[model samples]
Target: MRKADRPLVLDVVGDRVTVEHGADVDVTATGRAALVAQYSRGNVMSRSLLELVRQLDDGGYRCVVVSTCESPEPLVWPGELPAATVVLRRPNLGYDFGSWAVALDRYPAVAALPRVILTNDSMAGPFAPIAPLLEAFDTGHTDVWSLTDSYQLGRHIQSFFVGFRDGVLAEPPFRTFFRKVRVEKEKMDVVHRYEVGLTRTCFGGGYSMSTQFRSNDLGVGAENPTLAGWQQLLAVGFPFVKRTLINDPSTAPGAENAAQVVRRRFGVELSDWL
Candidate 1:
């Protein structure tokens, strides 16, 4: 088979991308290549996804299926795709980010035989104008790529900072605890006192560390039974209170920027495969 005619499979993870070959039994082995894009319903951006489908079709890709978190029925724009291209749908596993991790881990088995071109849903726009889909196939760098330039990177950073600040202010222990204590109204003093007791027990006793709250009501506040139960587990002999604040920027810009700075200081561009 000609190189241009080889199959291509795309594994999309919201704004992240990973690529692999399709399996022998899959559509790619039948000579018609496939480009699969995973869509999460929780994601607010769909325009880029739609554009990617259109671009792939225009570039003569065989299949353009959008796996969305909606129903089994995929949203297909027939006119936007070529006759050879087919759109199919599979059920999305709700709005869980972990679902994408599960999907990417399994993608190698699902589309292992065909030539793969992995890209993020966000890359669809930059790709739409420059045939980025074709570039993925041409350069053989389909694992992951950044579509936006440095300016957009700065904007994204600013937005993240603002959101983080707002989130910190709105956090339960910080906002709710302080607000109730400051408000001197005696209409429901007992309830407020009870809340203060629980808060004190959790934080003051060092039981709230590394604990996550689970709530029965989707909209209501969470309850950390483990923290509540931990109060009883503390040994009387080891009465030293050790409080640690877990703030990890490693998952975000701290590690990323550090790596970037190292590369820049060394006057090198980090290899993508690393």
Candidate 2:
């Protein structure tokens, strides 16, 4: 297929473009892809994010990356994206959720695929090969899955990364919920309505949800975990460590950045995955 180029569709301004990687997506593939929503200050893309894209591409996923530029400069995507991945660039309006909604509405492949992953740049992960995790999730019985779940927000599946089975994707409630997503400028509002809301809606609609790391291992509320606790999350087959556990730019304060702490003590930088 040809390299993705700017197209005149959905909101466009200047050189900003929306593109999907492949012309024909293999909907029957056992391994699924991640619809990544990434944000940047300007034209340049994040190296870590690029590495993540490459890993997803190599891992047999037809990644549909949604790049949202949060700067005055027009989105000039830097570097070469894999031919197997689709990318869309737009103004950062509704944070990650908005980008996800736009990509789902515009890309038919996203809905047609049997297994779909709605994830973002918030985590630095797959320090080791992700093949094992992918194999675990390909079971075909999961209605919804997440690397990790959070109880702090009323037992809702954290929105940073969630898997949608074919049943959920092809249904009306899922489409209606995502399309109706309001663009909330406030981070908390988005968190409440989307991050927490999506999980609840899916469960309420007769869908099941689960997480890799059992919160019981982390204690009730599953909020503050020690360094060993973080390691155990990965030890239990959870892929992609949440960046906030280390240092979150959000107002929430944490003990330490797990990446930095793990590196200082274990000499292994999980974010170094490439």
Candidate 3:
């Protein structure tokens, strides 16, 4: 079948999803909120996932929801979703990266899918930057396009370095991984230092021109450190997009500015999209 004519099947698994073709398959079943709540505590982007699914549904993409949790719940949304969407809850069989690799090996169809868009949450709004990612799939620029957060630098540094040095990151079933790194205060000086010396060596080399706005959510602040790690990664050379504002009660106007900046930079209307 022609590429554009092919069905767009999105699998929303915990932390990631695998897509496949076939108009008969379901996408909503793979994006259940309960399954996501299993991996996260408190308010772990669950609302975001719900919103994302809604946007994708409006955009005319087929979705499927899957549960990788042990005692999976009947994944459901508070409001109505597109009728065309499908939902499925599978028995949670412990499947980490290693196990997932084995499963893909066994199910070649999963690995052989034409396009896949994997995200940790369903509420990622205005995913325009990812347009290139979808294009990459069509052009065969990569086998896997893993969607990542913009504020995670320490994680990216560790993952990328480990993968580059030990070749452990060179496993099968994934070729290109897209990570979004953001900028913040604690790491700004370090990033500037790198920009002066070894900028080209880092991912998305040099600091991002955009600034970040964070909310004063006690939970988010408690969980994520400053963006120093992200700055470091940028200095080293990884391509990333900034997630300007974090939705926290502590920061009110910051969120508004962040939304505006993101909209200006990416031409994505955060209010309209989110």
Candidate 4:
């Protein structure tokens, strides 16, 4: 069968997570966020992640960045990172989860911070100030929240940007999950281990979950995130735009694409990183 048409199967053989057809991710735990992000490349000309870190810092949120790449090399920052930001670069063992583990193992100070955010350089913006967004979530009113929740793979909060308050942040189970996670190399591994795994753990542990963008709640259907969906996300104070639509555009095409429309209609440049 063609690789794409083949089903992915993972079997746990003792300590090794073997896959049917996949590559290995060497998640090296060299170090360890109030707002931790996993950077994919060594040198890139994008200011989106840095911008988010700055915005979060300005809002008085402690921020740490775990810089990494698929290969073990020196990760580069385009500009001077704030002193409050603690950064470590290593091999991309487990994608975001590997980065998360690096942060937890290296920095014990953030191990039990009252609140924390796990995010990555997946999008572009803070098109507007994020203080209001943070204000709403940081008020300690919700146990947890994210910019959005997805029904893909399963009903799980998209891992790009998830915030945790003391309820789950201070719990033993939360840290344990992070500790035991494998350096998963498969896409399904990420979905099952981190995305769905984290959400279920938090919810099952009695922590409430919330999001900034909801289609039904906002009177919008998932017709096309570019149609009015992007605007809706922006209007709700979301700080970034997914790079897939604008920067690479795996889904949209030509002028009809969401990135081009966002630029023409809203004047929001989604390729600030490019």
What is each predicted model's overall lDDT from 0 to 1? 0.30, 0.65, 0.31, 0.60
Ranking by lDDT: 2, 4, 3, 1
Candidate 2, which ten residues in sequence have the lowest lDDT sum?
1-10
Compared to the true structure, candidate 3 yields what TM-score?
0.37
Clash number for every model? Answer: 9, 4, 28, 5
Candidate 1 lDDT over residue span 1-274, tens digit each: 3324321122223343222212222334332233444555453334445555556545544443435545333343323434444343433422212232233334323233333333334221221143642443334422212221111111111000000111122244433432232222242332234233333433543332211111221122232211221122121111111111002223322333433433444343322201
Return whichever of 3 and 4 wins on TM-score: 4
Best by lDDT: 2
What RMSD value applies to candidate 1? 23.0
Candidate 2 lDDT at 222 equals 48
TM-score of 1: 0.31
lDDT tens per residue, model 3, 129-219? 3334333323443222222222332322111001111111233313221111112123343232222112223333322221122212212
Estimate, for each residue in 46-80, the C-alpha lDDT of model 4 and write its tens digit: 67777777787676665666655444544455676
Candidate 3, overall lDDT?
0.31
Clashes of 2: 4
Off by over 4 Å in 2: 1-17, 20-31, 72-80, 220-231, 235-239, 245-260, 264-274
CA lDDT for candidate 1? 0.30
| TM per prediction | 0.31, 0.78, 0.37, 0.76
Candidate 4 regions exceeding 4 Å error are 1-33, 70-76, 218-231, 252-256, 264-268
lDDT-better candidate, 2 vs 3: 2
User: Candidate 2, overall lDDT?
Assistant: 0.65
The per-residue C-alpha lDDT of model 3 at residue 6 equals 24
